[model samples]
Target: MVLPSVLNADFGDLGGELQRLTDAGARALHLDVMDGHFVPNLTFGMPIVEGLRRHTDLPLDVHLMISDPLRYAGPMVDAGADMLTFHVEAVDDPAAAAQSIADLGVAVGVAINPDASMDQLEPCLDHVDMVLIMSVQAGFGGQAFNPIALERLRSLRNQYPDLLLEADGGIKASNIADVRAAGCDCFVVGSAILKSDDYGKAIDELNDQIASANPSGANISPGQEATR
Candidate 1:
């Protein structure tokens, strides 16, 4: 599934921007909530999520790049977050954090930075519904796709075949195929879609690439071949 991040969207017309993505066939919206302390950048919060909820019915996958997600998770959930992902490096206890978020009745997820390994997530994987692997350093947008993420994704796929693995940051049509082939089922894209001249066409191009890249054709069935 393609989830266009709101961080790069036009703030002047936020609602229209979100609607455009939905019209472009994006199934979900990636809301990056950053606290200045945790990520060196401040971004959207519950009020923004609340406003976005009134604009679109798309599921909000809220990525909390904050130091204290335990304090904000419930508020985000109440603000209409369908899924919440917190960084493993942000909290003291991943398992407890997962349970706390899960207790709020929303899908829980764990995110790891490019330098982190699967071992960091071992304690919380059981409670998470999805895993977000940062393809670039967190807290920034429009960075280049890191090749190392592909290797890590492959290892995760090998160990957890059915887990919903997501690749976030620096994802575009150029690398979506490689990421999908590396075992990512979900994509968290930002500028590629938001910065495009045509939202729907950009999304279609990404979908086509993902579908064609599937070797087994189990996940996506496309008419054209995915170009490397």
Candidate 2:
């Protein structure tokens, strides 16, 4: 699935930008929620999330770049977040945070920084609905996609074949195919789409690249792994 990160979108015309993406056939919207304490940057809060909910019916993939996710789970869910992804390093107990989000009836995901190992998320893997491999450091957008993420994607795919794997950061038409090949099914594109004058066209280009790359592999789905 293609999820356009709103971090690079025109904040003043967010509704319009979201509508354009929806019109282009995006299934979900990616929101980067950064608190000053987690990373160097600070971004939107729960209020913005609540406000955005009114403008779009698409599922919100909320990535909390904060130090505390358990504290914000309720507010985020109340703000209409369909999925909540928290950093593995942020919480003392990843499994608990995953359960906490799941308990709130929202899809839970675990995100690992580029330098972090996939092993850090093993305990929560079974509980999460997805795993996001950050291609770059958190807190910033438009940075170059780090090649290290490809190996992480490969490892995750090899270990949990059916898990919903997503890639975020510096994704563009040039590297999207390679990313998908490495095992990312969901592409979280930001500046590439938001910075372009033609949002729909940009999305179309990304899809086209992914289609041409034709990622080939097999892995167990999350459901199958759980049963195993």
Best by lDDT: 2
Please give, for residues 182-217, the per-residue lDDT of candidate 2 as tens digits. 888888999999899888899889988887777342
Residues 1-228, model 1: lDDT tens digits: 677888999999997887788788877788999999989889879999999998888788899999999998888988998888999999889999999988988888899999876688999888788888999889889898888889989999999987778889889998899999999988888899999999999988888888888844333201010110
For model 1, the stretches where C-alpha displacement exceeds 4 angstroms are 215-228
Clash pairs, model 2 backbone: 161-220, 162-220, 162-221, 162-222
Q: What TM-score against the true fold does each predicted structure earn? A: 0.93, 0.93
- Summing lDDT over every window of 10 consecutive residues in candidate 2, give the lowest-scoring window: 217-226
Global lDDT of each model?
0.84, 0.86
Give the TM-score comparing model 2 with the true structure, all chains together: 0.93
